[model samples]
Target: MSAVMITRKVRKWEKLPGKNTFCCDGRVMMARQKGVFYLTLFLIVGTCSLFFAFECPYLAVHLSPTIPVFAIVLFLFVLAMLLRTSFSDPGVLPRALQEEATFIEMEIEAANGNVPAGQRPPPRIRNVQINNQIVKLKYCYTCKIFRPPRASHCSICDNCVDRFDHHCPWVGNCVGKRNYRYFYLFTLSLSLLTIYIFTFDIVHVVMRSVDNGFLNTLKETPGTVLEVLVCFFTLWSVVGLTGFHTYLLSLNQTTNEDIKGSWSGKNRVQNPYSHKNIIKNCCEVLCGPTYPSVLDRRGLTQEDLPVPVASAAPSSSSSSSSPVPQTTHAVLCLQKTKAPLIPNKRTPDDAKPSIAASAQKSPSPKEENPPAPKAPPLASPEMDVETSINKDKTH
Candidate 1:
C-alpha cells in the first residue's frame, strides 16, 4: 500500500476530533481528584509530623536542637519529589511520530506481501522472542500504531506511556520513563523519613518512661501514642516499596514487566538492554537521559528510523487463495442485517402468519365491500298522527 493510502486508513480508523486533541472532560476530572488527594495526604502527614516534632515534651527536653530542622528538610524533599513526579510528562508519543510509524508499518507490510495495494488489514498482536523470553507486542486500535517495547497503554491516563511502570495514586501520576527517577527518590526519601520518625518516637517514649513511669508517661503524652502508631504502620509500607523498587533497579526491569513475568524463563540470563553491569543499569535508570536512552537502545532515534514491521504469522491452512478485501459497504451491510429469531411451537390459532402468507391471505382494502348507508329515524307516534290529520285537511 502507498503511504497516502496508509495515512488515510489510519486517519479514518482514529476519527479523532482534531489533530492532537485529547478529550479532557474525564481526564481533567481525574487529574483534579488526584491533585486533591495528594494535597490531603501531604497536609495530614506534614501536620502530624510537625506537630509531634515541636510539641512533644520528650524531644524538647532531651533530643538535639537540630532534630526538628532535619525533620523539616526531609519533609520538604519528600514534597518536592512528589510534586516533580506528579507534574512531569510521562513520555507520551507524539502524534506526528505515531502517524509516521503507521506509514512505515504499511510500507513494510506491502513489501512482505501481507497487505495488497490500497487496502489495510486489522491490527494483530505480534509475539517476538527476545533474550529467550516471549514478548507479546500489541497494536493499539485507538491510537492506530503498534506499542513500543516496554511501553503500555495506561487506562487511567488514557495514553500509551513509554517505559511505563505503574499509575501511583499516592503520587497522582504514572511512574514512567520521564519521572521514574523522581518516583524512586520520593519512595526512598519517604521510607527514610518514616524510619527516622518511628525511631525518634520510640526513643522519646522510652526516655519519658525512664523519667516518670511507663504507665504515667502513657497517660501524660497521649499524642505520642497516636504518632508512634501512625509511624509504625506507615514505615512498613514505605520500606517495602523502597526495597521492591531497589530490586527492580538492580534487575533493570519495570514493575509492570516484573508483575507480568516478562523475564520468568530459565534460559533468560540477561535483559536485552543490560550492559552486563549493575552499576550501569542503575545509573541509566536513575541519572542518565531517560526517554532518549531507551529509544536509542531500541533503535528508535529522535528522527524516524527504518524499522521493519513484522507481519502476522500465517494460518496453518495450505490454501493459497488471496484474502477477501474488506470494504465500507460490506461492513454497513453486515450491520444492517439483523439476526433471525428462534421459532417457538404454537397452537393453530395462536400461530402468527408469515409475511408471504399474510400477503396472500388478507383482502385488499379496495377489493373489500363497504358498509350500507343508514336510514333516517321515524317521528314519534303522536307527532306522526298530527302530521297525517294536517295533511288530509290540506288536501
Candidate 2:
C-alpha cells in the first residue's frame, strides 16, 4: 500500500497566523522603513527647492522678490499634502465591517450546505444586478471578503484598499479612498512648483546671457544651471502623473480598475461610476467622499456589486453529462485529498463496474458520510514484514 497524504484546505475566514489581526504588523513595520526613505527624499528636495528659489544669485537678481515667497508657500503646501498622503491610513476595512463580513460569509456557507470533510466548499460567486446587467467583484481570500468595486488588494501593503490607485514608492504609501485627494493635490502642486522654478530659471539664464556672455553666464550661475537641470528632469513625471490623475478623475475611475479593463465593455460607452458630468466626477474624487457616501451618491450599496455565485447542483442525467471544470480553489482541494492506502488488488476489468456504479450515483445534500481513514505507507505487507524482521534482529 502506498502512503496517502491528506492535507485539509484552510478556509480564509478561519483564524490563522498573521491573518487574524486587522492590521498586518509586519507590513506596518516595512511601511515605516519605507517612510524613512521618503522623508529623506522630501527633505532633500525641499532644501534644494528653497536654495535654488532664493539663494541662487541669478534668481535673486532677475526674479521679483514676491516670486520666491509664493514659491516657498506653494512648496510648503505640497510638502504638507505629501505628508498627509504618506501617513494617512488608506481606508483599511474597519473591525466592525470585518465582523459583518465574517457573519455574511458564515450565512453564505450555511446556505450552500455543509461540504463533506475531505471536499472543498463550492466557489461562492457573488454578483449584483444593475439595470439587468451583472457586474462581478473579486473575492480576496486573504481579507476573507468580497472587495468593493474599484478596491484591490495591495500586495505591498497586504491590505485591501478601497478605490485603490497604486502604491507610490516615492510617497511610501498607497493612494486609496481616504488619501487619493491629497495624493492628487501633492502631484499637482509639485508639478506647478517644478514649472514655476523651471520658468524663473529660464528667465534668469536668458537675462544673464544678454548682460554677461552665454559662456560666462553658465560659469557664473552654476546653481541656476543645476536648478534648471533638476526641474527639467523631474517635470515630465510630475506633469504626466497630474495629467493621468486628471483623466481618471474626469472618468471617475481608479488606476487599478482602469488597468483591469473593468469599466469598458460592448454594452456601454461609459462606465457606470462616471457621472456623465466631468465636473461632478472631479468633485467626487477631490472632495474626499467616504465609501458609503460615494455609494449612496451613486444609489448603490456595498452589496450592489457582483461576485462569483456558488455553482448550481449537478443535474439528474449525471452519467451522460461531461464533467465540469473545477474552480482553482476546488482543484487545489481535490489535489490535496489522501490517496487510498491499500492499492486496489482488483484487476482493471473488476474495477470498471464499481467505477461505473459510483459515477451513476447522484450527489445529494442529505448524504453526510464521514471521510474514510487514510492508511499509512508503512501499512504495506512488504514494509510490515521488513519492520517485523528488523524488530526481531534488534531483540
Candidate 3:
C-alpha cells in the first residue's frame, strides 16, 4: 500500500505572506498599516459633514437650491474616487512560481556563461528596446524575475508592482499601473472640493454679514468658522499634489521615475512610454483598458494530494514503479547575509603567508633528511674481557 499525504484546502490569499489586510473573506484588500489612512478618512468625512451641516443649508436656502445638490454630487464623486484608489489592486506583479523561477535562473546562467554559484554572479539585468529607445530591466530578488520595464519593488508592500509610481500613505495603497488614474483623480477632486466648500462658506458669510455685522455673523454660526479653518490648512497640500501629478500625467511618467530623474536632462534619456502628445497621454492613461488582478487571492489551492495505492503503484517487476514525490511549495526568502568583503582572486600580499607556510612544511630535494650516524663497532667478547682485566689492573 502507498503512503498518503493529507493537507489543508485553503485560498490563495491565505497562503500569501504579503503585508496586506483582507476583509469580506478576501474581497477587500489594503495595506496592513493604516494609521495614516484612518486619519485621512476621518478628515475627509468630518470636513464634509461639517460643510453639509453648517454651510449647505444657508447656501441652499439663500442662493439657488442647486448649490447644495452640486456639492452633494461632487462630494460623492470624490469619495468614490478615493475609495477606488485605496481598494483596487495597484498592478502588483506576482512572485514567480517555482517552475518559472527555476527556468529564469537557468536562462540567466546559460546567457552569462554558466558562472559558478560560489563565484560572483553576473549582473541580473537585461536590455530591451522600447519605442525606439533602450531600457534596462533589473532582476528583483524578491520576485525572482527580471522586473518588467518601469516596475519596481515596494519595500513597504513587500511586492513588486508593474509600472510602479509610489507607495501613498495618504490612500493606504500603492499608486501604480492599475490605480494611478484613480489616485490622480482623487487628489484633483479633493482639492477642488476643498476650494468649492471654502469659497461658498465665504459667500454664505458675506450674505449673512450684510444683514448682521461681520463679527455678529461669525458669532452666530461657529461651525462655518471651524469648517473654513479646517479647509484652510488642508487646501495647499492637496492642491500641490494635484498639480504635480497633473504634470506627471501629461508626461506619462510615474512619481518614482520623476524622483529618480530616469528620463531627465543630465541622464540623456527619453521616456519611451510617453505618447509625445498631451491629449493622447491623458486618454491612454485614463481610458486605457483595465487589467484584471493577477493574484488569484480568492481562488482555492489543492496540492500534494496522495494517489490511490492501486493506481499509483505499478507491477512489482517494473523498476520505474514509483508515485510522484510529495510536493512542497518553495518560498522566496529575504537574504540577511552581507556581501563579501574582499575580491575573489587573492593578491600577492595575501598569498605571501600561504606560500611561506607551504615552503616550511615541504623539504627541498637538496635538504633531504640525512641518515642517522653509525654507532662505533662493538668490541668482541675477547676484547671486552681484555678491557675488563685492564680495568682491574688499573684499579
Candidate number with greatest lDDT: 3
Each candidate structure's TM-score, on Cα atoms with residue i matched to residue i, is 0.58, 0.59, 0.73
Descending-TM-score candidate ranking: 3, 2, 1
Candidate 1 has its poorest 10 consecutive residues by lDDT at 4-13
Candidate 3, position 47, lDDT: 86
228 Cα displacement, candidate 1 (Å) = 1.2
How well does candidate 3 score on lDDT at residue 266?
A: 93
Task: List candidate 3 stretches off by more than 4 Å.
Answer: 1-5, 114-120, 303-395
Which candidate leads the pack in TM-score? 3
Candidate 3 residue lDDT tens string, 143-195 = 89889999999999998999999999999988898899899889999998999
lDDT of 1 at 284: 88
lDDT of 2 by residue, 317-362 (tens): 6644756666965877655652222224354766777655654564
Error of 1 at 14 (Å): 19
What are the clashing pairs of model 3?
A: none
- TM-score, prediction 3: 0.73
